[model samples]
Target chain A: MAGAIAGALAVFFVLSVYLLPQSYLGSIHPTRPGPIVTDVKLSQTQVVLGESFSLQVSATNSGEHADMQILSIAFPSLSSTDGIVDVQKHDFRQTPLFIKKDRAIGAGYTAQRLVPAQYPSIEASNRPWNSGETFSIELSIKPQTEGEFVIFVKAVGLPHNGDQAHWPSNGTIDHQDEFVSVYSVNVTKA
Target chain B: MNYQRGSLARMQESRRLVIGYTLVSAGILLAASGGTWDVTNHLLNKPETFFAPPHAVLYTGVASALAGMALVVSASRAAGQFDWSAKFLIAGVALLLSAGPVDFVWHSTFGLDGLLSPPHSVLVSGMVTSSIAAIIGLVRASKVLPAALIVVAILPVWISAAGAVHMFSLPFSNTAYFNFNPHPIAGAIVATLGFPLITAAISHTSSELTGRKFGILSATAAIFLFINTFTSIIPNEALVSTIPFYIATVIPFVVADAILARWRSPKSLYMAGAIVGITFFMLYYPLITHTYNKVMDNKTVWGSLTAIIYFELMGPLYPVLLAPAAAMGILGAMIGQGMVRRAILAGLR
Candidate 1:
């Protein structure tokens, strides 16, 4: 009887492990309400003063069942700092660029210069980003000072299913924005 | 004691008991191998699916262990003989079985977990408990079991106990849902104190049970080194530089075994235990470096680069740790001797 009970448990365990949904057992950071940044990579974290570095990042629609659009990827800190760094080049073509100045942002962020590094291509920018598809952004930056600096990267987009008129703004360099990632760059005097 | 020589012999020779013990031993060894492989796979950034081969092997061993425990319990009851080892085996099996479901729920809720999460702790704790059961079981039946089997039993006890210590000290237990990571100083204290204690305790038990046998401790230590080297060190190209250093660690184990065999006094036991205990840091090698990393503020990404990080940390860390670790090992040996004496008084042998 003890053997039989153990055998039954073994069968149950095997079934649970094999048949469970991938959403339940496989991955973390499940589908959210907006497009979320998935991965961020820097060409170099430490660069000589006045030298250039690049930031490569990707975002995906994290809506559980709804498709979202890739509106823009912004660096909200570069423009605010006095002379620490400057955005040199970006890969976004025929997209609008704007400076959001003196705007009180999300939680714990004092109002500073908010700069949109790149907006999505206009034709498909408003269309659904689609599930499993990613929006990649690359920016070349030059450090103007010889100290460590944090660049706050955020994605802005909205689920197509939502009826809100303007793009639902999710980009904020603050603690409340879970979709934001902070990248550090250390500049050395050479 | 109620057990006569004839009765003890009959118990050892019982066919069901023999089969039960063999199955349990094989099952645990299989699980230990799978656990090691699983950690390696995780390090390699392989897919974290239940269908992964390592998990299959580990769970298969768990099933086999469950079946073996059931058989052993039934046979012991039928013979009207129930000992502490059998009880420990049953409790260990229960904990092992329960850990599966608990771990599943934890993963489902928290997504990915680290080394020291609640469920993983329970699982390693189960492994330690069952290993102790096997060691005591084989030690008591030493007259009938071969020396090879006893050595095999000791291997799991050592690996599993090391795993249990790593669970608290590896500095990787925090997850999205919960922060299970212990403080760095706390982890350092645990590893510094825990590793030697485990090593010396196991050495003392093996020495006393084998009648201060000359080769048993060395044999078990050799097998452990070979297995860890094959699974952990040999696989990563970066760890190649540390191979000779890892191999050199077995000298103390050999020396300890020789000392215990030739000189059977308490003083020699303490000396042997300290020698065996000092080897704990080297015995665990690259993985043990994580605890040291925590205290020294060395950040690691824990992939191929981990080898370079461990090598750098070892130079500064080993000198500070050796003496305290040896002191703890002596204490462990005393505790282990006390355990053997208690078991003898209870007629386990």
Candidate 2:
């Protein structure tokens, strides 16, 4: 009886060890995408002081599914004392861009357009967008008495899905930024 | 006059037991409470789920400590010659095993992504060390006590295996069941079951050779061997492999207890426990590091020590500690046996 018991136990032990290598016992499912911003570009690398430079910023549906009201882009510098110029100098503070898809852009599929950056009216408050699409806006640079001026281009947004947005609008998301240089062009009586 | 003298001696013995129990219990409680907190912080991505307000981890900790103290006091009171050291050792093992399930349930309920992410190395060490201690204690204790302890040890294994199987078959299975996954609770149960059986088997065999009973020793030795075998078969990367190993360890201990009926010859039994305990400790030392830093690996330390110890003691390598965690098992058993021998000698004098 003792031998039989020991033998049975030994068999079980061996069997358990054998089964230890079996995979797929504890697996976790993947999570949905949070948020995304896309197609952020500067029109020109070097521009004459007081000349207009375009920044084409857009929001897109880069996630697995289209999310609603994903605050894709915001231009906080438009309201600053130095306005867009201060933002260009120190890089735009990445703030959370609010997206409200209820105000559908154009065809309700893609939202693409250019705004004059020189005017304060072209601000994030005026633009509400959704993801799975794109939009562009132009900015005008005016260097006060420029030796060399740098302007920043930034885009931020989240997926339309209800998942928390990965990119925050209030700060530089992972410090990604686009810089535009403004050189003062002298127009002497030549 | 003789009765008065005997009562005085018993009083002194009881006082000593109480001191031993208090010290050991305090140390274990401190370690478990501190270690669990550290483990929760390091292992859990969202520790708030378990450590946050309503749950009150501190209350649970206090309760566990009180339970441990109560068990120790009860054991000492019930058995006039109850080895307090052994009780502490068993309690430590119980704590180690319980920690695993607590962590598992916490993770499962919280929707944590990785089921076995960021393994708690300290918790693992505690479980391993506690198990060795428990086996050593069982081997050195009286026949009835060891038998009772074995039954207690078996319960966790059955529950853990069932839980693991259920978790594995869940509709939404997580990645926790993978091989090399650190499931503290399951590991605890496996250690509890395996160490006792191995120690008992070794004790029994040694008793037969010396004309005595040593069931605990045989059980401890068997568990060490089983752990070593399990380690050899499953690499650290294979997290899921532990489930079967756990099942394997539990079944043998239960079977051995049923067959052996009683362990005789406390000294020989303790010797077996010590050998298995120390061997397991040495074997697992290399794998005990918190970080998987290859530069400072020390698995061979125990293996070499085992070879030397066995050669010097038994005129052969014995190959017991050559198994995974065998060094720890042997070391703990030795420590336990040493304590038991002292107690026995004191009782005799």
Predicted structure with the largest TM-score when compared to the true one: 1
lDDT, residue B260, model 1: 77
Question: Model 1 scores what on Cα lDDT?
Answer: 0.65
> Alpha-carbon error at A83 in model 2, in Å?
18
Tens digit per residue, CA lDDT, model 2, B1-349? 9999877766564544444333333333334333333322322112244555323533454344345445555556655545645555555555555666766765576534332332233244443344334333433433333343442332222222222322222121234343443343444334433443334333333323222333543444355335433332222212222334333444543443343344444443443443333332222221221111111221211111222221132112223323433444344444434544554454344
> Deviation in angstroms for B52 in model 1?
2.4
Model 2 Cα lDDT, one tens digit per residue, A1-90? 646755774575345323322222223111233344455566565556556454544444344322222322333233332433322321
Cα-based lDDT at residue B262, candidate 2: 49
Give the C-alpha miss distance for residue A149 in model 1, angstroms: 24
lDDT of each: 0.65, 0.36
lDDT accuracy of residue A180 in candidate 1: 47
